[model samples]
Target: MWRRVTSLSHLLSSPKSSPQLTPTSYGPKIWETLSTEVSKKSGGGIFSKERSPFITFVLGGPGSGKGTQCSRIVETYGFTHLSAGDLLRKEITMNSENGAMILDTIAKGKIVPSEVTIKLIRKAIESAENDKFLIDGFPRTEENRIAYERIIGAEPNIVLFFDCPEEVMVKRVLSRNEGRVDDNIDTVKERLKAFRSLNLPVINHYSNKGVLYKIDGTGTEDEIFERVRAVFDAWK
Candidate 1:
């Protein structure tokens, strides 16, 4: 998924787990205040001196286990897990005006606009009480990346790319049974095409910045996470 980037159509599974729901050390009151503060502030507003959270961007093909590994990471490292796909799905569920548009976009295996995805992420960050975050399956395009930096006034501290083969990714997605809008064969193929044309440049950008950690994602979940844990260990 990460290396050759020839195809990534299979990584588009429904995100079944969310680390964002995990409990935080901060109380509800703290979260309430934090949410208020974040809501009032626009992206790139003032407070340039304010430090953002420790963010780790997890990138992979649709079936590369980004969601599964994020759950493990949250348990082990106490980072809030925020899946961009989940956030977009939530917007759909809430019947937001943008919901239909988002659904159509995903159904076609095209990326939702950066503004929409970034807004959801910014809200999640503002509401979160944790200082560390594992933002999964996001910044899918260079526009997405630049929008995040411009609006959030922060860049990810680390980027983890799951390097699974296209064949492996395709098999996993085919068997995922996630009931996702984009899980069909045709959509998956388009998503793979989008991954190469849209997402790879973002990955290359992060790699050049020296914060990208490429992990072999061909093994069982536990085995892959062992590698993931080692990366975190080294970071610590």
Candidate 2:
């Protein structure tokens, strides 16, 4: 198992001392109340000292090959792969209660509520038997980052940010033909805008925390995975 090196000081600190999260007009009181109830029922968090998992938050803009790299990591390192996007999409497919909300949010290239996304993620992690996990395309905003930390009661062991150029990412997405609703030019542009405005801060936050590994996201799939392999291998 990978060792946890991040200090508990921040994880255990009072909310006031934590980094100030971006304010949103979403119903914060309702979310916090629900999150607290869920956390309490889940034994203070999805993880405990005895069952803490090795988590790697895989971050990148759309078509940055984060999903591709996550698959390779899971195959090579025995870590379970969980894509937040995939989970939300699954909810849409199942026509769950949040299906309409998630679909509309995704279609507009807006983020789903942290409360909803975090619940799905927590459920996925709890159901998996693996002690190592690669959570791809997550913590897309500072709100996401904070909500996760508050509800999960732990920090990722490491974070991987795939740095790819926007032009390259757009070309790759357009040609990949994934049939995703947000793969077209307009949505891709919106997603990129969202990435810059929201995701970059989360990336910088991890970098500041000293647990982020940035990998070159150019070139062939094999080439990119090679760079990713070096990071995971070192962790091993």
Candidate 3:
């Protein structure tokens, strides 16, 4: 799936998973899209700088147990978890035009607009009350990464990829019972296809940068979380 995001296909594919969802590799290419442009408002005081904390980009497809692992990370560590899906879903709930499109696209496993997705991520970053953040379910495209570097101005400390098979992910989503509109098998299939499409390139971006960490995604929630914790432990 991570492969699809970065080596991403234009069209949707089958279901899959990658740590909380690390199945693929990421490298420097994702950052290649960065432009030299910077906005003064978001540039945030280049003269008198505070310490820049490392960011952890937690990436995965839907039902990849990212949320579960994020909870564990928050409990043990103090990093904030910013879920892109949750943010988009919130927009859908509010009945925004973009939100409506996102819901439709996600249900069909299609990629959302990079600009819209990045805008949501930027919002989360600006509103962050803490220095450390675990950005989840974002940058599913090279474009996503570029937008972040362009708009957000910070690179990730590490990129965590959850490695799980498509079959496993499909089963998990079907049984998830979260009452999400995108959780049913039909929509899940589309979501999975979209996930496969966007994830490869994203993963490749992180892997090439040597920041990608792959972890087995099969098992109970605790088991999966333990793998995630292990990454943080080594990093910390």
Candidate 4:
């Protein structure tokens, strides 16, 4: 059922190009059209007011420990963990229609199109039985944030920004042998550059919206989770 609704048939025939790394590469018209089609097919948006889940956007640079903390949150609080990166990686491994595109974008340390990422996220949310969700490594750009709001027709309940030093983040990424294509020094540097140039604005936007929690990510795993735990506990 989900496969039929979330199929990438529309994008499969798209011209092959190194996806532009800029935030405004795709216009609002595209999102509006896709959103409308999705809404019509689903009978409504994926989320409705009464059933709207508790959503926390977990954000951080590479190796900022957001993933580890998300695991802790799921264990302690029972929120369903949804890592956008993991979802995209699964697409690549499964050789889905969007696999090659997503692989190229990630290798270049660029973001996948909001349309593709958002559909994957929506499918995950719809399939899950849990109401509360921890969405990690998403909305890496203002465009991503806007597209999500426009398509999902809802805003995250809170946004978590794991604040960590560049030096610390780099050191951690270099040491952690995750065997990911983007884990190399060059790719990690590129990811940091993209993060600073793109992700920070999304953080500031959420901060201005008063839903952003800036957590100090420079500590032992337990220490950082404690800070993250406090934020979730308050929301609880």
Residue by residue across 78-162, what tens digits does model 1's lDDT show? 8999999999998988999899999989888899999999899988887877768889999999999999878886667678888
> Which of the numbered candidates is closest to the native, going by highest TM-score?
2
Error of 4 at 129 (Å): 0.3
- Write candidate 2's Cα lDDT for 103-186 as tens digits: 999999999999999999899988888878889999999999999988887777788888888999999999999899988999
TM-score each candidate.
0.79, 0.83, 0.76, 0.81
For model 3, residues 1-236, the per-residue Cα lDDT tens digits are 01213222311122233233223434544222221122222366221144343467887776777788888888888888888878888999999878778888776766678788778866776667675678888788787887777766666767777767778888888887888877788777777777678778888777777677776677899878777775666444
The global C-alpha lDDT for each of the candidates, from Candidate 1 onward, is: 0.75, 0.79, 0.68, 0.77
Off by over 4 Å in 2: 4-44
- Candidate numbers, best TM-score first, in rank order: 2, 4, 1, 3
Go through the candidates in order and give the C-alpha RMSD of each one to the true structure. 10.1, 10.6, 8.2, 13.1
By the TM-score metric, which is better: model 2 or model 4? 2
Give the worst 10-residue stretch by lDDT in candidate 2.
15-24
Summarize candidate 4's per-residue lDDT along 1-236 as a digit string, tens digits: 00011111212122221111112234335534533454453346565433445678999999888898899999998989999999999999999999999999999988899999999999999998897799999999999999998888777767777888899999998998888989999999999999999997898778677567677788799978777766655433
State each candidate's clash count.
7, 0, 45, 0
The TM-score between candidate 1 and the true structure equals 0.79
Model 3 misplaced stretches (Cα beyond 4 Å): 1-42, 45-48, 51-53
